[model samples]
Target: MEKIKLLLTQYQEAILYIVFGGLTMLVNIIAFWLAFQAWHMNSSVSYLFAWFWSIFFAYLTNRTWVFHSTAHDLKTVINEIFQFLVARIATAVIGFVIFYFGVNLLKQDAQIWNIIQNIFVIISNFALSKLVIFKKKA
Candidate 1:
């Protein structure tokens, strides 16, 4: 029990990130399914819908819980939000490329390709958030 607690404490940020990231992925997947499967939207359009919702959810959870951001001032807050969005946009472009290649070019399943792209997005997003957006202040 003590060992588990220690480990949890040590990796609290990563643990919380995974938890929130999973929820974000769920939001993206569900949105994509509804748009693509139910509403019969184009795969590209559906991906955009999923990306918007997931990005919104991710920003909120990452700021409040995962990174525990402390940007109190208006300027700092704006800067943080800008940086976060930029980082997400960068990763989103990568996801779109992967999705386009897998689903459009190679004729793979849209759902599977979306999931694969998202895995990459999640990993890259974590790196950006930790190393750049949410880095500890010197």
Candidate 2:
């Protein structure tokens, strides 16, 4: 029991990050499905729409829960938001490329490619958040 508690305490941040990240992915999947399947939007448009929502959700949850960001000042908060968006935008572009090539060029299933691209995005986003956007100040 003590060992389990200690491990959980040590890795709580990572565990919370995965939990929030999974929720963010659910948002993305639902958004994409609605746009693509229900609204009959183009693949690229649906993907971009989903990206927007997921990023919005990710920013909120990641700042509040995952990293416990402490930037209270207006300037610092703005800076963090800007940095987070930039990092997400970079990942979005990479995800788009993967989706495009995998689904469009390679004739793979869109659903499969979406999952694949998101896995990549989640890993990269975690790295960016930990190393750059929400790095703890010394």
Give me the displacement of residue 128 in model 1, in angstroms. Answer: 1.5
How does each model score on TM-score? Answer: 0.74, 0.75
Clashes of each: 0, 0
Judged by lDDT against the true structure, how good is candidate 1? 0.92
Q: What's the lDDT for residue 4 in model 1?
A: 100
Q: Pick the candidate with the highest TM-score.
A: 2
Candidate 2 Cα errors over 4 Å, as ranges = 92-120
- How high is the lDDT of residue 17 in model 2? 91
Q: Please, what are the lDDT tens digits per residue for candidate 2 over residues 1-138?
A: 999999999998789999998899899999999999999999999999998998899899999999989889999999999999999889989999999999999999999999999889888989899888999999
C-alpha lDDT of all candidate models, in order? 0.92, 0.93
Off by over 4 Å in 1: 37-40, 94-120
Shift in Å, residue 132, candidate 2: 1.6
Query: What is candidate 2's CA lDDT for residue 82?
Result: 97
